[model samples]
Target: MASIGLMGEQGVSAEAVPSLHERDLLLRRLADLAVLPPGRVTPQERALVDMVMATAVSRLDVAQRCRIAERVAQLPEGPRELTLALARDTIEVAAPVLAEAANIQGSDLVEIVRVTSMDHRLAVASRKILPPAAIDALIEYGNTDVLRRMLENRSIEISSRSMEVLVRRSASEPELHAPLLERPELNQRLALLMFWWVSSGTLRVEILNRHAVERRMMHIAIADVLEGGLAASGADEALRVALSLVHPPATIAKPQLTRLVNLATLGQREEFVMELAREARLRPETALRIVSDFGGEPLAVLAKALGLSRQEFGDLIVAVAELRSGYVPAKSDIERITAVFDAISTDRADLVLHLWDWSISGEAQFPLPAEE
Candidate 1:
């Protein structure tokens, strides 16, 4: 039996003892515990300790959080398995607390997912890791929600084998199939592979046409088969499948269109230029010509190789119209080009803006039709 003491006493009833102050003291100890010098624990152990602390605290004060993140980042590569083990231990210790922290669920916390397996916990964690490619190689569990998490991982490389697995699973379980329908970027090769799965009688056509299926997927489906490098039979067949879908009206609004145009103009992806033009309902030739404005005659040479007429070649100049306005020929602008071409000819008309546009814009005929 414990005796109660007056005021501050050594022996007291449990109820009489100060509880709040003890917890307060414990918190202070924990706070101090969080800041031990780097030498106190090995880096791997330090990372483990952080995961534990991260999981334990209701809200890890900013300082502790920073320390833990720093420790984890400082870990060298090569022995990922050890680091992963520590992360797992940390997750087990603090699961409940971290599961509630909003910050832990965000992209800032993707490193946590990188260390964990695909499971219910990962599924919840992945909601914050958008665009699914985050854990493409990390996922081992086949939980649809976990697989759905893959949708957010943008870099998820779905090969034929992986796509086949997903399609089969989706057919047997419609709930699992739902997320794939929403991703517009699903490439044509994957789409064709799905069709092949259906053809082989491994997947049901009825399920393939479910209301969950997004119509825009059809466009990428064809584009992927045509453009995505894959050794597969029947490219023409895939194109036919794309044409069969009565595609919904395009949704590229003004801001998006302007953004795409800016992207096309600034970047040199002829493929992107061609695709953007196709999206805008412009001819591929027109799109090619626009990029040619900045690209100069190298692109024209490519077109010529593809069989454009010499008149088309003449149309590819960038000279400013009317010499009075502060303007110069592209040749005058390029010192290397001036040195090279100046030796061959003095006529700078080839660099004249109007003549160049005429040559490129299909206005002026070539001096000589391409040596056909």
Candidate 2:
């Protein structure tokens, strides 16, 4: 079949163009040489091919060069010099060999990528089993077409960091969404992160349905994954969330916080945690978690949300610390907790409080955004 693709960069150069008759003879000879045994190019064959090519002109147009490249690329020892020459030829002549020639190893792909245009880069991107170095180069320099082809090329492996970059870039390229979502590398956390940034409402819902964190699941995950997590207590976290929802602690009036603060001051830990839970609309276990945390940041934030005065906040810290052990917070710890209260805005505290209301009790005071 005739070479069927674009004609590109339609000219070649040599020190001497052989006479028409000489050119015809060399063309016939090169054709014969291209059919030689795989990996069997003799020293004699190389010498003759080189001598003739130096003077033998290619009346061969781009298509014919592509044809010659096709044939030469098939022969295991076709002619390394000739295959390389054609591979560096115009985009049309080079693309087929670059895309499908298994013999074009990683290093050769690298060199071709450096010297050729977009067609070559795209071809390199579509190859099966691309070398890590070749993938690195494509990720760095390949254009949109090349990037799309690589993302779709399931046979190729992409580095994680490169996939991360692609995920980030997809924020801008709406065209990239489908293939990116299908990628095995697009895990739940990254997909959720991307969902918030994506403009597509449909995609956002799809992501939420597929990867949404249930409240119980989230609390359990935190309990399992957090540093110094609450797992040592040996309580089932799901049951805690369940009980918090079913038999909640009674609500405490604002005046009750001062009374609870006094009880906490007297080392009555249970009364303080229970009343704090009541005031904050948290389960006793959840409230106790914040109070028991060594860093004290959660309690600080909750206190800030509850509108506790700085002095009451200090006493609350001391009372909660006495729950687990006699570990009085250091001066630096006290400073950090105080900073949390000062830095956290009221609106931020309200948001957290609302989420606690919604997630734990299935009640939201604020309406969700209207669906598009």
Candidate 3:
């Protein structure tokens, strides 16, 4: 292969420098050679092309380099070194190769994600299929925009660990909520945890509609154990809570429930939480979580589970909203809470309550045995 000798160190005279047409021709030739099938291009030819591009690529203008990148990106089996060179170029030059090249190895993608700009990361995130290592690197170095791109990329199969990290991030990065919720990788447990922080009524409703599963299978699986007194013996805290939901104690009397609502209305948070816990047969911590949830769906579910009338549920929503400082329940808020309460059946509400209890106890797992 003839040297382009475009490097400054070569001391080529200004008059001797290649013309724009000549430089474009060289770039086109390099791209043409790079994409040739192995059977069509010899090892010697491949090596020479790689060697020439290694030096000549730096001399091309951005448009010329991007042209080569766009062409090389479609190659079924291009030179890996050429792909890496183009992928490491400016985002304008690298975007095509990073987002579309199949020959770029997973490890190379990881390195690119680590060292590149946000634009490069965004391009990588848009790839048709991202490897796990590449996904991890993106999550580690990417900001919210990069992650949102990955979450929206339906072709990417994000690992459970990565999903967990994003779910945790979604608490503070509200921009990630919709895309993260849409990801197929999200499971019920993570969705439930995200429920407490998600502010969108549509998203909160989606979470409950999708994750508030019935516990019939669990009930069937543990029927024998409950009958045998294992739950009473404290074999498993989660199971014990599940059993409580199965054979609930006497309902909290209406007067007592009204007193709890009054406490919340008056902003007596601790007292309201404690009284609700006692009457609902819940741990104070569990009741606190339900009471603290600003979305009001969980509390609505709890209200339904306890057989509260629609009016009582509306009152609880108002009281809880007042309990949280500076938050006043709007008419729309009351209607939303009432709709949620009315939509849930008593049986499903009981199961959701049991699941919330188990989640609060720190025992929630994906694909719970019952779910499986």
Candidate 4:
């Protein structure tokens, strides 16, 4: 990283003033061209300015670029060369800046991508703010690095088509594919695939360390996927990967956990739910709420959460019944009872057999604590 030296330093001051003046002239010219009629500037001069502005690193260059772009934007002709060159440069030039300069419509930018060689920088820029057509081209040919960097931009919404691109591309390289995991929203299918992939040690430790809750959920989901036969051999691998988690497992918020169990549990893993019940130690009402909330199949996720094996979950059901029979229990009590069950129920089918009967009796009734 060679320094350019300070632009306003003693020796630099004299030269800096002239640059500022030049920049001012370019800015005014740019503004003038924006409002000028279509025929005001010749195509050749407009093209020349576009090329210079696109490649310029300084504000003076951008000013000049803007002027030419404004002029060319009005022309029937487009400046494909300028846009392509701008994309090749490393400086953080913005796409909106280029679009503004040429007065070119987003549709026109799409046309440029169709005819031009897809430079990585241009592809990245287009993903940031290009029209739908250009977006299509970037998806078709953008490099993995460029696409990964593009994912960091909040501007790009994950649509089905975009998700398809990520899923298909994910198989190519794990390192480059890591950023997709950071996205807060993804299509269900894509999220599922990513969950499994990341759970197998494909993801970097830093990512798991930085995003604890996300990583835990991902680990649990991978276990569920393996158990469901989607990734048959993945269970051991997923667990092995999960063991690498540096921090304690993420805490599932009691309210959210209860809601998910009560409302979103259909077709989910029974083993996971059972494990979660043991760890959460939820009272019968809370457990039943979680189970009913889940509508069914909360077992698998629950089991993973509590770190319980299948046999232990059955005992947890029995313990839950006892706790429920006693009284409406707190979230902590539910966890304690299930933990006690996990420690004792080694392989007792009899204990396991009693679980369903207890589960049917449901969670104990309890009053909520007053809000502080």
lDDT of 2 by residue, 175-255 (tens): 677677778887654564455346554565455445433344444545444433333435765444433322212333557
Worst 10 residues of 4 by lDDT: 345-354
Please write out the lDDT profile of model 1 over residues 1-372, one tens digit for every residue: 232211122222477437744643343344333434457557776555445544454343334333333443333321233233224444443343223333332342355555554552454434433334434333344466666666544543454445545644554445544455454544433332232123222232222222123334555666546433333334553333333232333334545444443454444355556654555333455445435333232233222222323443233222111211323345533443222222221112111211222223322322212323
In model 1, how large is the Cα lDDT of residue 44?
A: 70
lDDT of 4 at 339: 47
Cα RMSD to the true fold for all candidates: 21.1, 15.0, 6.5, 18.0
Give the alpha carbon lDDT tens digit for every residue of 1-372 in model 4.
342222222222455678676665554444343333447568766666556544542354554443344444344444555544443333333344343344445665555555554453454443445555555655666666556665666665656667656655665555545677776655333443343234242342323223223334545655644434533436463333323231233345555544444422332344444544444543233344444421112332344454455564544343333323323345554454344344332222112212322322221221222324
Error in Å for residue 232 of model 1: 19
Candidate 3 — which residues are off by over 4 angstroms?
1-31, 227-271, 278-282, 314-328, 357-372
Best by TM-score: 3
Per-model TM-score versus the true fold:
0.29, 0.51, 0.80, 0.36
Ranking by TM-score: 3, 2, 4, 1
Task: Mark the regions of model 2 whose C-alpha exceeds 4 Å error after superposition.
Answer: 1-18, 39-59, 73-78, 212-372
Give Cα-based local distance difference scores for all models.
0.38, 0.62, 0.78, 0.43
CA deviation > 4 Å runs, candidate 4? 1-103, 115-128, 199-372
Per-residue lDDT of model 3, residues 1-372, tens digit only: 864333222223467556865665656666667667788678888978877786678677787677778877888777778889999999999999999999898999999999889999999999998999999999899999999999989988999989887887776788999898888888876787777667588888888888776667767876667666853556576667656656432356899988988898888989988898877777788898888766677888889888888887777777787788858667787679778898888767776676667555653433222211
